[model samples]
Every structure is written in C-alpha cells, then in structure tokens.
Target: MDKFLLQQQVLDRLAEDLLQVEQALREAHETATHEENIAENKYDTLGLEAAYLATGQARRAEAIRQAMAHWRQFRPRPYDASQGIQLGALVCLVDAGGQQQHLFLGPDGGSMRLLSGTQLVQVISSEAPLGRAMLGKYEGDGVLIGVGSIRQQFEVLQVD
Candidate 1:
C-alpha cells in the first residue's frame, strides 16, 4: 500500500467535510442577521442562542481548516516498526475476532475511514484513545484496547 496516496485520500475526505462544515457555518451565521432571529421577550434567548451556535460552528470550521493545513505540510517517512508507532506510519492489526484492519497514524484527522484502491485506510489522531494505544508499539506485539468495560485484544501484524 502507498502511504502517500493514502494520506492524500484522507486529506481529500477531510477537505470534502470542510466544505460542508463551512456551508453549515454560513447558514448558522446568517440566522443571527435575520429579523426573525430576534428574541420575542427579554427572557427569550433565541437570538443569543443563535449567536452562540454560529460562534461554535465558526470555530469548528476553523479547526478543520487548520487540520487540513497541518496535513498538507506533513511528509510521511518510511517506518521501521522497531522504532515504534509514530505519525505517518501505516499499521496493520488483527483483532481477537480475526478481523484485519489497516490504520494510518496521522497528526490530526480522526474517525475517517477511506478506501484507497484495494486497501482500507483509517486515519487517526495521536490524541484519540485507540490511536494513543497504537503509538509506540512494535510489530508482533499485543494490545488490549478498552471500549467501556470490554477490553478487546489486537495483534500488531506489521507497520509500513
């Protein structure tokens, strides 16, 4: 699998998301300027609530833009599993159920699974729980990641 291509695919997916988010932010911000957004009474907080929602949406859109910028500047290096997991490393793991997964340790993109030709690439941020557990791990190692009270076993097959 080509890591660089996978990276680009992830970025493309995030870029698509950014577009939708920006459009949503525009709609949210537009609400504040509309006359109907005005509160009916002092106790009615419709206008104030619209302003808050628009502000939050703007921040969210900005964050996604920053993540895209970060991804654009990143250069993926060849991985040596002995060095442990790091950003830009493509990792392969098998779960206790015998299911195999291909994961990319990325700097910012999270919860995005992309289909890169025949390979399925999952982009994860280092701050995420599963991403954190995968970091600093070598091939042939075992990891137990907990989702709530259940701990799932995973075997590190390789890192590319």
Candidate 2:
C-alpha cells in the first residue's frame, strides 16, 4: 500500500476509535448519574457505592475527553513516497532477535484486530522508542530500540 492510502486508513481508523470512545464515555456518564440519583434516596451503603462508581466513571470520562481532544488536533499529512519513513506509513521491520513486526501509528485500543494478516503493534504516541526512530526515517534505515535493559537493532524493510 502507498503512503496516501495508508494515511487515509489511519485517519479513518482513528476517527472511528474516537467515536466509539466518545459514545462509551457518554453512556458511562449517564449510567453513573442515574445510579447516583437512585442512591441519594437510599441507605448510606448504597449511596457510597454509587458515589464510588460515579467518581470512577467521571475519571474515565475525563480521560476519554482528553484523548478525543488530542485526536481532533492530530492532522496527518500525506505520506512522503520518496522512500523515507514518514508518519502514517505502515512499517515492516526485522528486529535484532529475528522477529518480524508491523507497526501502525495509531491510538491504543482493540484496533489491532483491524490489521488481520500481519502482526499489529499500536503506537499510541510519537514519543515511544520505536515510534521515535521511525519518524523522519527512510526505508532501509536501521534503528536501535531499547527494550528494558536490552538494545535491539531493527531494519526497516518496507514502508507502506
């Protein structure tokens, strides 16, 4: 797949994930509010439990909102097809240990299932080691990634 197609795919996937998260957060918030209202008229034990659940739900809702805000400002440019590594490119690499991997620059979720044929590694942010190395790199570039105390070299075989 070319860079443009890959970029479009990533954007589409990200948008979909954002929508799902937003919906879930809305549902959770509504449920929590309902529970809290019901508990307000009940015993202290039930009210406490409801308050706890409501707090947890509120936290999750905030997190999802923050993530959605971040995604909204994320503008993925068209992939540079000139042989170098660029954002939105699907990269295939062989690690030093001889393991083959496919890395997709995307949000962290169950979206890995969308990558059916190859192994999918979700890069939630650009600061990660592998993610950092892949940025501004070209095909055939070799990068060393630190995993815990061990450092492994990965060769970029292809960029899609």
RMSD of each: 1.7, 4.9
lDDT of 1 by residue, 54-138 (tens): 8988888888888888889989899965679888888899998889999888887556888868787878887888788988899
Any idea what lDDT model 1 has? 0.83
Question: Residue 124 CA error for candidate 2 (Å)?
Answer: 3.7
Candidate 1, number of clashes: 0
lDDT of 1 at 35: 92
Q: Whole-model Cα lDDT per candidate? A: 0.83, 0.60
Candidate 1 displacement at residue 137 in angstroms = 1.9
TM-score of each: 0.89, 0.58
Considering every candidate listed, which one attains the maximal lDDT? Answer: 1
Q: In model 1, how large is the Cα lDDT of residue 29?
A: 77
Q: How far is candidate 2 from the true structure (C-alpha RMSD, Å)?
A: 4.9
- After TM-score superposition, the amount by which residue 46's alpha carbon in candidate 2 deviates from its true location, in angstroms, is 5.4
